[model samples]
Target: MTNPYAASGVDTEAGDRAVELMKQAVSSTHNNLVLGSFGGFAGMIDASILKSYDHPILATSTDGVGTKVAIAQAMDKHDTIGQDLVGMVVDDIVVTGARSLFMTDYIACGLLEPTRIADIVRGIAKACKAVDVALVGGETAEHPGLLKPHEYDVAGAAVGVVEKDKILSSEKVQVGDVVLGLQSSGLHSNGYSLVRKIVADNNWQYTDLIAEFGRTLGEELLEPTALYTGVLNKLLQDIRYQNKFSTMSHITGGGIAANLSRVLPAHVSLDVQRSTWQPQPVFQVLAESAGINLFDLESTWNLGLGFAIVVREDSAASIIGSLRELGVSSWQLGVIEPKPENAESKGYLSSAKGTHGGSVRLVGEYAK
Candidate 1:
């Protein structure tokens, strides 16, 4: 018997198969702390672990994969996008020194493609396992008419817990602190809108290779965001980094200047040296081919540095050395200086400050 719903592009059977395919991957993220089985209406995580803290504060963040999914779809790659989703969501929680507990993902698509759905979930599960976050539950919505058959969007939310007093923020950031830059794998999920625009303008296919990039454009663009949770979590436990690690700025949508400004106080300013570390090849290529000015490029992309750490001046070398031991490359970009009360700091202060924003200026020239 032919199912009437199948004719409309929605298949309950395929949905079931997708769940069946992803069950093992999802279950692998669970530990004794996760309650119940894989399929559930709501994810159950044991919060009893929080009792270990004097006062545990829960941190939650949700984010989508953005236009980067378009690149993934162009090349028929689904796995890495899920990691991008986790990187966008979970990494934000840990920015406040929170240890990620569990994550849930939502997938919306035109039809039920079990293999594709499973591939996405597998990527999320692999990332969750790497950082000890439980993948408790997820929803795959089959939007039959709204999206094209191969079109889908991925978003995820993560929950974490941190001791009340141990929470990290800009409040801890002070003048004389050293700012360290964490090297990114590639673009790390931002600036994709401009990336796609550039590719379209240049008539470049995902499979096309540029001499500088070595691999196909799709391969470089699809490089998953570097997950920092595991390493940062270790650093948080060490006494040397305890108070020295004041705050962090996850270089995302607004680039280095805007993001660091979020964690800087009004009285302080972040002076970033552009030449301290090399900008990734992708960003340099985009600037040369697209004719994007350095400042405009900084506003749009991470420009190689993914995450910024603010620490005491004495601790910079120790922190940088520790991060290197963990395979995370870092650069000592600049320092936190007092924000001049008058207009003398115009060029040094980035005007992107919000109420909490501080002056952030990029000094020095790009390392050509």
Candidate 2:
């Protein structure tokens, strides 16, 4: 009898081999709470930690590494991509004031290269350990004709827990609250499609940028996504300061203005001072070389701010100071204001403090 799976270009044997190679890499990330083995369809996590709360809200987010994967392929590095995968999803869940508990990944490829798959799993393990989450299980499919022989895509799903009363939603945000900007590790995966075009147009090789990074362009581009687990977990631990932090936003595909607007209530608007922060040099280089408009830069990339915390006016300094103490570069970026009465208004009604001694107005459509 002919094997239908083989005819379809998926080799079960190769898939098995890939799993075997990734077993150790995945197991290394397991802690006391990981249940069963590594091949389960769904990961099982011991959620007894949540028993203490009267009502525990489970926050789950799924995301891909985006076109940043192309850079990884160009650089021939796969390890850090998994961390980027986990970060993209986990950070989004955490914005709701949740603590990541467990995560799983999905890797699909036209052909399974055991070593490359293992490298990716290893990266996921490293990131899970840093965030104190266990990697319970994941899937690796080997579909020989579905993808380019050497090309693959990766995505992830993360589960987080937050006390029922502790979810940081827009409802708590109010006028007079201060916006705190947390510095990002350059680019952080989004806007890479534009980045690649810029790099190609400049006639600049990845090698040209590697010198500034003290590593190869691939290594720098694959730099693991920064984990905010510990810092946020610490801040959420203080019950007295719970209400002080009214809203949190993870700046991802949408830049600051877009993401922040998501957490703003109908009656409130965010006023960001651009001069309050400096865009990372990589962004500047890309903008100058690619001829990307400033508005596009602000709308697409994070512009160096990855995470934002909206806190009461009085708690702003303390939050910034605390983040600094934890080795995170954060600053007061702006404040919340009453939304204009005219619903048709498309502006911030105010501007960000720019680095050039001028106000920078918000130019993108708010995230609805």
Candidate 3:
């Protein structure tokens, strides 16, 4: 019998084998909530728990690894990309106070390598497990001519659930709120486009950089994205704690300024003290080597702060203490201020006095 699918470069056997491998990898992330394994067109989760809430909000976000994939490919590391994929999507949902319930991923590549694909899936499974989210389903496509050999693009969609009344938005933010900064694990999958160029221009290789860390560059960059789920989950369990948490921001592309501003109420402004923390050495090296302007570093890369928590100033100390107790590094990076006289222009961000080496505003300006 002649097989028409193979003739079109779609090998059913190859896909089947790939699916088997991915299924095994994904199974490790499953829990009681996951209805099935890898056979369904859409991932299914047990949403029966939502029936208890009077008003439930379903939050969803889709994102990719972005240019960070090039770095993973250039370095031949596949494991951490899955974490990056999950982080990018789930983080966006969490900003609205949603809890990630389930996740699905999509990977398209020109050629299929069972081992490589399995590696990516393993990473995804690990991240999903960390966030207590189930990997319900995913798609792996083999398009030989559409993409470059050994090149694959990864994207995923995450669905989260929250009580409608509990959704965190700008309206909840107040002028007297304190902005707490959460430390990031270097770059956290964004700004890699600039990182790549800087590394290339400076004649730096992933191997050279990893040697300094006493591990392979792939190992470091592949360090799974920090799963903030557990921390935030604990924080939200206590009513007292939840009330203090006004707004949250996930610092991704467009860096701190842009992302932070997204959660700030229009009636308030934020004054960030740049001197509150020092830039990580990796950022310093990249900036000096590439001669990147300070403004670019702050607005483009995270400058080491990955997440921000906007909370009432009175509870700032306790919140920081609680996060520290959880072994998460955090600090008071800034404070919320009253808006300027011009009501329309009220919600503007400013650098605190003596911060950013006294060039705070210029250094943290929005990147065009």
Against the true structure, whose lDDT is highest?
1
Per-residue lDDT for 1-368 in model 3, tens only?
Answer: 87997776666677777677777668877888778656877777888979988999999999998888877777788888998898888888888888988888999987777777878888998888888888888888988789886889999998888998888887788777888989888778887778778777877767775434567554555555666776887787767686788879888877676677667755566667777776665666667678776555777888778888888888899989999998789998777776566533433443322222111121233212
- Model 2 TM: 0.88
lDDT of 2 by residue, 235-336 (tens): 878674667988788888766676776666656766677777777666666776677655568878888888888888987888778888988899887777
CA lDDT, every model vs. true structure? 0.88, 0.76, 0.76
Candidate 1: global Cα-lDDT? 0.88
Better of 1 and 3 by lDDT: 1
Residue 126 of model 3: what lDDT? Answer: 86
Which regions of candidate 1 are displaced past 4 Å? 343-345, 348-354
Give me candidate 3's TM-score against the actual structure.
0.89
Q: Candidate 2 clashing pairs?
A: 272-352, 273-352, 273-353, 274-352, 274-353, 275-353, 275-354, 275-355
lDDT preference between candidates 1 and 2, better one: 1
Write one digit per residue (lDDT tens) for candidate 1, span 157-190: 9999999898888788888899999999989999
